[model samples]
Target: MTLPLIHTPYAQVRQALLDHTEIALLDVREEDPFAQAHPLFAANLPLGRIELDAWQRIPRLDTVVVVYDNGEGLAERAVRKLQSLGYQRVSLLAGGLQGWRDAGGELFRDVNVPSKAFGELVEAQRHTPSLPAEEVLALQQQQADVVVLDARRFDEYQTMSIPGAISVPGAELVLRARTLAPDPRTRIIVNCAGRTRSIIGTQSLVNAGLPNPVSALRNGTIGWTLAGQALDHGADRRAGEVTPAQRAQAAQDARAVAQRAGVRHASLADLERFAAERGRTTYRFDVRSPEEFAAGHLPGFRSAPGGQLVQETDVSAPVRGARIVLVDDDGARAHMTASWLTQMGWEVWVLDGVDRSAFTDTGPAPATLPRPSRPVDWIAPATLAEQLANEAPGQTAVINLTTSANHVKRHIPGAWFVLRTDLERALSTIPSAKRYVLTCGSSLLAQYAVEEVAQATGARVLVLEGGNQAWADAGLPTAEGEQRLASPRTDRYRRPYEGTDNPREAMQGYLDWEFGLVAQLARDGTHGFQVL
Candidate 1:
């Protein structure tokens, strides 16, 4: 049965933000369109991904969720899906995206605008020290006593880095910086793909009161390239183990910073109490490296490496005003990450004094969800290949429900890329066939859509056994590029700093955007950010 859609006015949403109450303003469009424009605090939970992500992102069933789309007729569908998944308080943003604009709301461009804006605010308030790429390069040329720390993920560091930078991702900076540069006179420079992590990471060291002078590599690698400086590709340098004494000192320093920033320390009992508060949304994150998280972690804690957590808080925790509990075995990482969270207006706590044995769970954090009520028909890769080879030209319709980018990168040779939300309409454009096959990155998403597709088409519907990955692993031929597209490539937003070939204007414009975030934050007046 379809539930009557509840309409929430723009005033109510804005009031929720200003009042510092829990509100999840979800943009239900794909990433590309969402990135082009969204409210400052809006989180992108695309329509195709509601079933897979809604539960994990908005943990509470009663959490106020207002979903919007830019006149694409997706918000109503999203509301229905959320209702089906047990979201009790789902509502449509009255008048949709245009309503927010008409109500004089600020629409932010690019993803993670809240965190990026916070970083800019921190830099503006704290005057976080930074050195331009050219100046840093000159210092390197002069053999200055400096150590460059890449604050991005290890894979990102491996892709491109400064000539002599080491991969000490944002969260590791405070815990490992002293060990990386034992000499008190050594100058430290931190960087990321762009500005936010660089500012946040550098400020973290300074906030911890690290002795050696620290500064961000202004605008990060983007600045390096813009300044006609070269980047070292495939660099493997990473931070090593910290000595006991170093760990102790780092812990002490980080704790002091956390305290100053009003970060609370929670005991195991306190954590249990927080968990019991079903009325309040509490997210428990193991703020450690992915490898460390996979090795061992407390039960119920999700893996969100500290740096990325701070950078992508909207993605991780969409419900603003929710409580956050960060866990880490190491004394420093959690505290350092918590310090940033506190400043970002999160009611954050660091789990303290927990015995190592408490970490019973092992391997990657499990993604648990309710199984589909109806059984799904699945086709193995080999069987699909045989059917494709033997069947008539229009016998089977293989619809790829993965991201457009992923579909373009690699997919079954004759597969048509279609948005799961647009399946019925997209199918009308495809040739009639005897059977239809559905697949995504892992077929997890496609499995959820089996009933919907079967209902809409009244055709034999089957999911690919393991999706595209299985097809490739079976040594089957794959095709690339935009061969057949039923929907625009809007699933994933192409980041300005991701690849090597971004236009100079776009890069500069990106940097220019960062420069103006502070003003935008002021205009919005809802962000409860504080800098220590």
Candidate 2:
């Protein structure tokens, strides 16, 4: 007997989008491949990570989820995985990516096309003001009243930024703009690595009804670099705190904007009702600074800085179309963050009117992870240390499945570093041993590989009790070098746009790719984007 076929055609998907119906148009490929070519609204949920990240990325079991790959045969496999996981409305893109091409749809390169393209659209439609990078530099050199704000994350800002730019991040722009530039006559300039966040950040201030004149640094740091300008590194300047009066005023202003975007506030009772809906996936995020969240945050909430949350929705809340509730110590941050999220096509709500005592968690929130169903043996750290110290060579083999960079930095002595995906084939080449141990920075990844390793090699497989960290804590020495690798490093891909060593052409190529996203989004026509 053959299994039934499920297909979602391009036209059907397009119609649903045009009609404003909800759908999770997913592309099941790795981040690197997914960056090469995909539709504007297609969220990448790689096949290798389906079991790991699927539940958190797609919340509703019955929601229409159309997954495709570029004829890589991953979509069908993903469909099976989703079905096994009890998803009811999973379907394959009719002809995979070829179907979209056949239907004359545009394929964009790089990630976050929706948000980036939306920025371009907003700039085009609203005519957000801007200055060339050179002009902005000159203004800074002249000690003009213009204040530059970096809209990227704090780390990214610290890496490289326009001269004298303070790190304000995307979602913080509206909340902190008034405090940063209280004078109505002060000019504000917003920027990011390239164009998206700069455009969005500048427009956010405009939308918030800031009295000062606002403009984006055209093309952002890319333009600054192209014009032979210098970028500051390791800059630690950040926006200062907002007072009680400022918080109240910002809350009122942000709440009005959220209302305009149809984002409602959720009371404690409303969130309780949401939590009760077990089948529906709901993500509750504390959208505050990492330091603030670590001091204490509401229970059952993950820490996602509001600005980074807007910049990387796929990373933060991968569950496309899931209901998101944002929490902030002050009401303004959540409301402002929710406003952008609402515009980005998310059903978002801000928690309001909660007492200060309601927030109650220490350290980071626990991760959302899935465990494999397998019977696995564990060797305690002390036992492993003793075995390493006393056992003869070739008696037991320890394989580290952590990242290559991390492995190079330090790993358990005599342990071989291998990629988890390549463990089976690589195992055959290694010297035979009576026992095998799998470990990572944590034991979670190692547990998923125990069954596979055991089945492939017919060996007694055991997991390190608490991974490599335990061995180190037990005073077991570690090794450092690339010579201990048992498999070729294929797990992590290096981004071309990162770091200071990138060639001029690669940087130029990245900008060219982003500048074309707006055109591709127009041709795709599946993205239901609205700019305010």
lDDT of each: 0.92, 0.80
Query: On residues 307-366, what C-alpha lDDT tens digit does candidate 1 reach at each position?
Result: 999999999999998999998887899999999989998999999989889988999877
Model 2 alpha-carbon drift over 4 Å, by segment? 1-7, 19-22, 71-77, 276-281, 381-396, 413-433, 471-493
Residue 247 CA error for candidate 2 (Å)? 1.8
Compute each candidate's TM-score over C-alphas.
0.98, 0.88
- Candidate 2, residues 1-532, lDDT tens digits: the string is 2346599899998887676565778887666677877777788876656666676667567778898988767788778877777678889999988898898878777777677787777787789899999899888888889999998889989998887889997878877888899998999999998888888888888887889999999988878888899888999999998878877777788788888988988899998999788645678888888888889889888888887787777666654557889999777678777888888778888988888798788898775665675887999988887887898999899988777888988898888887764567678878888899888887767887888788887889999998988877888788888867887764444454556677778778887777676677677766566666
Total residue pair clashes for candidate 1 = 0
Output the lDDT of residue 240, model 1. 89
- What is the TM-score (0 to 1) of candidate 1? 0.98
Q: Say which candidate scores most in lDDT.
A: 1
The C-alpha stretches of model 1 lying farther than 4 A from their native spots are none
